[model samples]
Target: MKKLYFLIFTFSFLGYITEAQQLLRGPYQQKKTPNSMNIRWRTADSLDAKVYYGTDLNNLNLTATVSTLENDHDVELKNLSPYTKYFYKIESGGNVLSGPDTAHWFRTAPVAGTVQPIRVWATGDFGKGNDGQRLTRDAYLNYSKDKETDVWIWLGDNAYQDGADSDYQAKVFEQYYAYGDIFKFMHFYPSPGNHDYNSVCGIPCQQDPRQHKGPYYSIITAPQQGEAGGEPSTLENYYSFDYGNAHFISLNSELGSPTAAYDWIGAYTNGASTSPMIQWLKDDLSKNTQPWVIAYWHQPPYTKGSHDSDLFYEIYMKAIREKITPILEQYGVDLVVNGHSHAFERSYLLKGLTGTAATFNAQTNVVNGTSGKESLGEAYIKYTDGTKPNEGTVYVVCGNSGSDVAANKALFYNGSPHPAMFYWDGGTGVCGSFIIDIDGNKLTGRYLTSNNVVKDEFTIKKQSVTGIKNINSITSSISDAKVFPNPFAKNATLSFTLSKPMALNIELFSTDGKMSRVLSNSSFNEGEHSIEINSDALHLSKGEYIVKINEGKSASFERLFKVD
Candidate 1:
């Protein structure tokens, strides 16, 4: 009788273990703050979901659990340290589902407004569930390796065709060809595209955002209460977050009024600022204290790729340029990225040109006409002072992540490249994405292709513009300045003319923005003066340096190169 009872009890225990729920989707992360993180996933059975997490991987003593039995699960891990890495795993009915492995960890965002090195990966129109998407994903993974991406932003059209629940599962969550490897790690912040909105509205996709509810809305978590920074947007479609020293705003271009004639124009109207999105944008920008501001959305304001920006029927593109762009420029937005055009396009440092392609006057619109390439010694620079406020913004059309541009897609305007664009694919039929690295005052952007090629790149540096009036005064006093035999082996002559007698000091700074040597410090009488920049004396390395002359409260800088 005792043996029969033991066998029956063992069989019942085994049966209970076999019925453990199976994980269907994400052990993925979403809407992270300094102290909290939202970890979401799906399972096959309706069962209680729990998360085991802690700073130490070997000992996950912390647990966040939800008793509700449902297929989809969202568990929030709270009271975490800021800028910290925590290892985590998901479970259903106490059944271990995912991991406490190496990839199963996330780092909280840095303290708000703090300066730190932040790497961002952005994809657009990539949820095609094909090899194109896989290749692009692989390229980034290969390029970054162990250097994890701090923020992953979706530039919209996240899923192709109908963007239904099934489509998101197959195209984004399930398929290895579409960001399957990425989910276990990086947290994504998304902005809606026209196709993503299709899931909310029906076939033709005329969405009334006031009543916006759909698969896309359900799958993603928007930080609506200023959890990351900025003012609380209160709506999921648009929001802002701060990472390090940069402020990022994710706007909703597809948000149209239920009352407007055309859906696209509601976000950016002709006269009065009726759009709550635009109002929030202005309010957000006014409060931002970060040095760099980067804003992104779906439809681009300037494009000549698969879509033409010059055409009137492209109301979305036109509306953004004419109605919304001025506000961004007004508050000095540094960069704007969009995806919709299925081709890579980058603009010159631009401002104030809100009209058609023909109206792009170089003098009035082009803030800096140079290529803005760091290697070419023409990296764009912005001043911290109020003088250069609202002067320039670099716009990037990064739509071709998965959607390859076909042969018929015109990549030009009026039989030539758009007057605004400085670099574009030029119909090379390549698929690419954008990678941005921000460290302190420098921001570098690269157009990286699927085959791991850097097709285009640019760097922007921010510097303080102090003593500008004094600088001009001193610059005029020193009429002529030259570095003779610049590529000097031993020494070089820095000659300059002084209109009036003054105390002056000559110093040399390395190209990396550090002072290398102080050549001279004395009072010089009015006349032409020359100082020897002796390489051996200063032990200067073979590289470029800036020769700065200080006269009281004023300073002037000139470039000098050293060689073998």
Candidate 2:
């Protein structure tokens, strides 16, 4: 009787262990577009999958109306809202799994030219199971907690050892879930890496069917021809979209060539330049007047890290120089963000090939000076005079999300072939992320360490648009002005040009039309005089404020901003 009891007890204990091991959660992968977001997870056995979501976390009144999809471990929830947050959960079988029950949240991106900031968390090579990975995850979560992050950009090599689904769950998902609350919110935007392709070599027993797809996909963030909000592709791995004052073009670095991605980008860029998207971006920028045009992909155009500037990938870079970057520059593009290197590095406003020197002449300056509502001219201007022109595109390498083995410390130094503004070895911990604040004409970026420290910081100012007062060339006694850093935090500088010197008065008012402070009351010179306004002294909070600048009765420009 005692022997039989012992056998039963052992069997029951083993069964419980198996069931506990099978529980699925953590490491949510890939959410795209305006309306719908997809959720991919795993379970130990065949079980019913359901997601409970709503605007209110306490009262998740809205559940996935459709029947739960069974058998498959991955599930996608569709028909969501743009720029709205939804709380969700996953259930296995009929039981609401408790361990993985942490509420997952996602915010849809606004349509093109909406003027809202498009926030993304980017990191690369972060699949190793180490302290660095944990630090990266923690920092990402900390930022997400404070900011409204629309998506998480994974530059590649998301899982180490092998890219098998199981390894992804163990190393990537489980390790991520170690901090369940922080990551439950943002959805992942992933790219492929060399290690991800090595599943065949490392995982003998496991065969992932998605290998052929290479985990490559594209997402559009606005309403489109075939779909309502936007859609994700299962076809070719690359696609493009227009989102809130920018045209986002994502490519497949591992599978496709520059030729294919270039053609696709050309069509999209040309269309955006002429289509309603252009007007929207223009209006968005006009209202917000944020000084940044941004783009992201898995590979870096310039890097001093483990992967030297890839000449093969340079073909794509050249294409961008010829087609895409020109358009962005024409539209006053401020930044281009990328990851692939296993460290964080930032570049100066660079132009041309490495080691090229050139001069800045009048014609060159005029050509580069062309701003808002102009066509991005031919490539000759960018690569002319044997030097690369700074059309104000700052390339950044933020691939140090978690995975850092064989990291190159030399890349961080000034003597490197491609010098970066900053670099970090794996010793400091693996994961780190960047936060960008786009307030009016200035774009400020903060690089946070794994422990939530601001490791590096930089700011890019928007170039003042010239020739606005050239309208006076056609009409005498005309009026115009400009205010910068519209979303002024502590202070903002306002500058304007006049046909002739005139006395000017500037009044800053709250959104409710209450006068807050007077920026300038003295008569100023005519060329271009900047007046600084201190916001904090006015005792105002973050919201839209109006700036009315008046020069006698003939000149004025009304601008608005959300103070931070």
Candidate 3:
């Protein structure tokens, strides 16, 4: 296996390098936005790095230079155009290291919050530094067939055993570099896993910010000030970012791990209103205007993979499901993604339940009509109208990118996929990754196997007031919608439709369901729309509030309950 792998590597990389200097790793991308991009690469020697880039391959007019001699090079090119592709070449000490080949290029991220087509490559527990990793990477490459990847997400366990620098060097950095130059062009957002929590001992910079110890702290550089999007998180361990129209969140579930007690960054509980991570999550979700939100971390909230969610791995999973899931659901998060167990587990759209597999009562918790495949006719619809805001969120366990089953293969969790799971067996033993593509209001997740087959595919259609015409509706105008998290705590957002143009009058009713206050009286254009209601400003106490929307004489009424 080692000999065969070495032959594959030699044949693949030997032709790419034509110089004397050894190209160790990277030319990978990070912290990419519409106007700026962080391009990084490493060399065998401390050499001054210069990047010659331009929109046209033939005329490389622009040059971004770093004079300092360094092996690990980072050149951030700013003031560039959005959603535009550019060709680039890396030069070291006056010598060209890599070329003006068409593959050597990057596209600036679409303008933040701008609706555009985006393809995201996702993986977890993939960094084994083995042939399996190579296979997974190759499979995606084959599946892509030259399509551009906007963002890549690593769901922790990026390296094997302990996430030491050497482990990551072989597994992640070198591995991806060997696969292709895509590592050099696409932005990668990652979180830490249990294996990544192994103490770094003497490495001070790698020490976990919250007093934990790990090498993962030193390896990753994520956005610190909403540079990419979402809320500002100075801490690199967890942050949120936006590309195109989807808001991507990377959380540290290792902090919530009970079994991995030594890796605590902080504790988050439903009882605590001011937990650092929890508060940040709420603030991030509350402020985000994006119609799509996709959040991922290391551990899954529900799974029967290598680790059983019913009997073990409960410390973090339970906290996430019971304490965290509600917050996400309240804000109408479209997807919850993670990878702890090493297998592919995609869940049916679920809501409002926390416990073992037995607790997943599809009859009540699952939205029968709210979710299905687009290819099958009905697509999962998340209503942004705030009325019947779809409570269902699909949870995908994508830990099988490079790694497979652990320990005894057939003896775990009764050796069967969880009932709530949609597609579990995708390969010889469920080794694959997920690709998330967002085009306007339509978001689809395709689980691609190592054989280049899309084993599972599903679509999520979001009908937002801001994007009324983007969805399937009878009219080019008005649609009536109500707000969600009905029993309100802080606020509400409603989705409504308008045909042509009309004046809208929204009113509030007291607990007795009597007209109490006029919320808004304004004119609206055609298509779907949404509005926000501030419950606290109304000085409303714990009780019910009735909301009525009147378009001239026609009216729609809904009830809202508030809690402290």
Candidate 4:
């Protein structure tokens, strides 16, 4: 017994000392399924690839070793159980190089059609190689605590200053090495942004015309054979994957289909039906058996920030909105997220009407005219009844993860008041990331910012026929309801009229369901009534708030605008 303890302590002490072997990048995971997944990494000198894994943390008795010598390491672990957790330790040259630690295990995806709670962390244009990127990552880490992500996707531009090998090492690998555990334990997926293909653009870091090749095209290993669960694309630039009961698609908007979108009125707008990527999308969604579908890319289809979607010259955003959106709508995609713009922007649930920003008639395209906050009793509905799919899709721009250069700050607040966008924020340092959680029939997404504030939260849930509520059943006497002088500074007045005498209960609540204060709780006579909401009392930041009025059983909620 004394010998065993001495040997164990000696091995652990040796592990802490003289561990000088450097891992160039990764231990990154990819191509995941219920029974299979691939692990990858890189080293400075050529070495064989090996991964020691098992169900128990102490004993990684199972071995998948490859004797071939190479700098880039890849080992596929197969014949695993569905929804099971496996502990692993990466190795090269017979030395235990990475993990066997606490944060070195991953849970296999649940079988298809199976229901489970899954979390995904998404960031757009985050490969800037700056402190802002680090802060964004740390903020998310603080928010998520020790909870591991099942699916993590990057919105592209993964490396800065040309997508070269050295650039990737400096900007991505070294700066993000602290997050190496995430790569080891979760499937890391990414799409190409314009910067990822910088060589193909004007400010070339490097370029290849021979096969439209760039650094991004060289490094990524996306699914082209439905290995991760989706219709096979047979192409690397675009692909899809499935996790539990949800399907996610990653597309290349920068060079999608027609190659490049021209600024002309209808350049690539009418060509999507003929584009290879679009055709694959149609087929993929048509055969999908999952209850939720999410698609993301580098450029956004709607924005007024650093990039303008309404501008005729920015044809990528326009063409995608006018072209690809209709197909997604036709098949019922729940969410579309992208990066490119330099701030956070989320749209109201919208359907149809995809002409231009000016053409987005709110009265027609905007569904559920309310603010889409479930706490305020407003949310878009999607029925999983197999017969009805009436919910509208929500678009989000999470482009604030880019570099924090002065020029980047200027790029962020370029424009505002995009008619189609319901929520947008951009300032010198207003940066954040988004979290999407799916548990059974409920899907909730919240925007977590650099300051650790969840500024926006929304939920899209599925309901059965029996769970549906009749909107007409509720009755209230509030009419000509208005909040003035539009956006009040200190005190805002809520005015409404009642046809008959009724009991009234007016209160203020934050968007996150925190009941702030009660404005009134007394019976009121007929005619007009006005109540003042003191901003100092409610104690909210400069944004929007929910003002609720309860008359007997029926309730009407209004969005109160507060300004600094």
Clashes of each: 0, 11, 20, 0
Per-residue error at 560 for model 3, in Å?
A: 21
Q: Write the per-residue lDDT of candidate 4 for residues 1-564, one digit (tens) a residue.
A: 999999999988876553445577777777778887777888767889899888999998888888899888878899889889899988887676788876788778888878988898888767767767777888888999877787888887777766676677676766353355466666677887877777444332222222466556656677779987899988777889899889999987765333333211133445454566777888999999888899999888888777777777777777787777888888889888898887788888778867767787764576444455667655555644322344578888888775432344443345435776677776666677878999987888888887788899887766643322322222457776656663466887988888888888887765455446788999889999899777887776555455567775566655554555
Give candidate 4 misplaced runs (Cα > 4 Å): 1-19, 175-178, 199-212, 256-271, 384-388, 404-415, 464-564
Local error of candidate 2 at residue 472 (angstroms): 12
**When superposed on Cα atoms, how far off is each prediction in RMSD?**
7.5, 11.3, 12.1, 9.5
lDDT of 4: 0.73
Count steric clashes of candidate 2.
11
TM-score top scorer: 1
Regions of model 3 farther than 4 Å from truth: 1-19, 175-180, 199-215, 256-273, 369-371, 406-416, 426-429, 464-564
Q: Please give the distance, in angstroms, between residue 72's alpha carbon in candidate 3 and its true position after superposition.
A: 1.8
Ten-residue region with minimum lDDT total, candidate 3: 466-475
Error of 1 at 393 (Å): 0.5
Using TM-score as the measure, name the better of candidate 1 and candidate 2: 1
Candidate 1 on 22-126: residue-level lDDT in tens? 777888899988888999998888989899988899999999999999988989888888999999988887788888798899999888888889999989988
**TM-scores, all models, native as reference:** 0.80, 0.59, 0.74, 0.75
RMSD in Å for candidate 1, one decimal?
7.5
Could you tell which candidate, 3 or 4, scores higher by TM-score?
A: 4
lDDT of 2 at 188: 54
